[model samples]
Target: MAYKDQKLSEEKVFKDPVHRYVHVRDRVIWDLIAAPEFQRLRRIKQLGTTNLTFHGAEHSRFNHSLGVYEIVRRIISNFENRPHWNNEERLLCLCAALLHDLGHGPFSHSFEKVFKLDHEYFTQQIIIGDTKINNILEKVSPGFSQKVADVIAKTYKDKLVVSLISSQIDADRMDYLQRDAYYTGVSYGHFDMERILRVMRPMEDQVVIKSTGMHAVEDYIMSRYQMYWQVYFHPVTRSAEVILSKILHRAKELYESDDFIFKLKPTHFISFFEGKVKLEEYLKLDESIVHYYFQLWQEEQDDILRDLCERFMNRRLFKYVEFNPNLQMKQWMELYQLFQDAGIHPEYYLVVDSSSDLPYDFYRPGEEEERLPIHLVMPDNSLKELSRHSDIVEAISGKKRTDHKLYFPKDRLDAVEDEQLKHRIIEILYGQGEVKDVR
Candidate 1:
């Protein structure tokens, strides 16, 4: 048999906590899993800084990636005998699903914010560039690697294949919602996934749900909404994220300072600080490698860098209070100066973090990031958008909910020896004459 047509004599099954078992029969998938590029995911956490909040959320991207592939595999199995489901696209969909998150760096979102790097771009490079994964994909056909990349990029001509992985209710979201919930030990992510899968119908360009499964889809949507607020956007998780992003920023700032000399050179971060990271260099800096640097930087001469590292390594996280952007603009400015007066560097010390989620949204013309809403197949075989059919979905559809918080090290504010300065700052922060900062 040709390389692409090769299969193992017996199926290989990985015991998964979420899926129970992830079965592999295709040689291509087994090889891809073993590839060094894909294996790097084991070191990258699925939910960055979240593990610090929920100890059980120590799962890695490798775990979630495998779960995504398994979900897609089951989905495709259902699609096989159905009309409009092309068997030829099966391998492409499977590969795309598995490799979709291949390029996520350690503490992915925080790293991206600090370094201006896009994981999706790196994922495309991994698929098409000089790498073991690219070689495996190229073995399938001359341009097969690019085809996989395009599918991931959502530019593939086969919109049906694209929807299977990238759509709002597709395998990627389905897997992560359950997997993240499982790892975090939260009840919000639970939903009737089996029913959703059973009701899935492949269309010419997309997947539609049978009207019978509308309730199940609604449950999934609400589960996602609850998970975002309760687990994904937990204030504690955001606190750690704020500190992590600051550590990256402080390190980058010191790297660019001409007068500053590192007692120990930041070898792992030099490329990232310079904004010209090579693919190999990017691959080399996983979570363990980042933690190693964080440990060493704890002893650095730079007080800000050393202090931030200590806070992250020891879990001395910043405390946050709800922030109203419209009303608190002036208050925030005054507090910024008060922080500076108290010898706390406002730049690194005070940060406003905002998180927003749109549980479901229909297509909006000319919007930069358009969400293709879920559709339901009616009894008469007509298709209707999910929000139109379900009152529950309609209640929150297209209406984005946003939360903002101002995060700062309350311990540092407490250590401010200037009693009046502390009291005044506390007064603004807590609206009390007492100096203690209230939660």
Candidate 2:
């Protein structure tokens, strides 16, 4: 038998918390799971810094990836022998699903933000680059690896395949919602995924849900909305994220300083600091390596680096207040000057973090980052966009909600010996007579 067509001697199953059991039968899938590059996901957290807030959210990307693969597997099982569902693309879809998050770094989003890295770009590179993953994919076919990369990058000619893995209601979202919800021990992410899956129909260019399942789809969309606020965007988790980003920023700043020398060399971060990270150098970094540096840097001579690292490593997170930048520019300027006057480095100590989400959006052509809206197949076999049929979806459809918070070291503000300066700063931050810990 061709290597690409080979099956495992016996089915292997991973007992999963959310999915119960993740079954693998293909030899290719088994080998891909055992590949060193895929195994690296074990060290990357599914929700960076969220475990600090929700103690149970310590599950790794490896766990989530397996869950995603299982979801796609079940989805394909339902698609078999159905019209508009091409069976030839099954393995490609599975491989793409399993390897979708291969390039996520330690504290993935923070590292990406600080270093201007794209995990999706790195994901494609890993599939096409010189790596174990590439070698295994090459054994499948001459250019099979590229196919997987295109599927992940959402550039494949097969829109149906791309939709299956990446649409508004695809396996990736389905798995993470439940998986993250399960790990975080939250009730919000729960939805009837089985019903949604059962009603899924593969169309010429996309997957459509049977109108009968519109209620389940509504629940799923609402679940995603709630998960964003309750778990993924928890204030405490955001505080930790702020510290992690600052730690990376400080490390890069110190690395670029000509006079500074590290007490322990930041060898793992050299390429990233220089902005020319090779694939191998990128892979060498994981949470363990990052934490090792954070712990050691807590003792560094550079006070900013030491302080930020200590905060992240010990969870001495900055406190925040509701802030609107446009209306409070004058207040912000005054606060910035006051912080400087008080001998606090405003650059590192003061931060404005904003988060926004569109719970659901109708399709809009020519829009940047346009997401294809979920479509429902009616009883008469006509397709209609979801928001048109559900009042619940229409209410919030295309409406973007945003929030901004200004994070600062409240402990530092309290320590100011100048009573007049301390009270003034507090008054500006919290308004008159409203001084309190917002955390």
Q: How many backbone overlaps does candidate 1 show?
A: 0
Q: Residue 14, candidate 2: how far off, in angstroms? A: 0.3
Error of 2 at 182 (Å): 0.6
C-alpha lDDT of candidate 2 relative to the true structure: 0.88
My TM-score estimates for the predictions, one after another, are 0.95, 0.96
Runs of candidate 1 exceeding 4 Å displacement: 356-369, 398-400, 432-439
The C-alpha stretches of model 2 lying farther than 4 A from their native spots are 356-369, 398-400, 432-439
How much lDDT does each candidate structure score?
Answer: 0.88, 0.88
Superposed Cα deviation of residue 403, candidate 1 (Å): 1.0
- Tens digits of per-residue lDDT, candidate 1, 1-439, equal 8888899999999999988999999999999999999999999999888888788999999998999999999999998889889999999999999999999999988888889999999999999999999999999999999999999999999999999998878998899889999999987889999899999999999998999999999999888878877887788888888899999999999989999988888888999999999998999999999999999999999999999999999998888778778877988889999999999999999988888521222322123335677888899989888777788877866666677878889899989999999988887877512222322
- For candidate 1, give the lDDT: 0.88
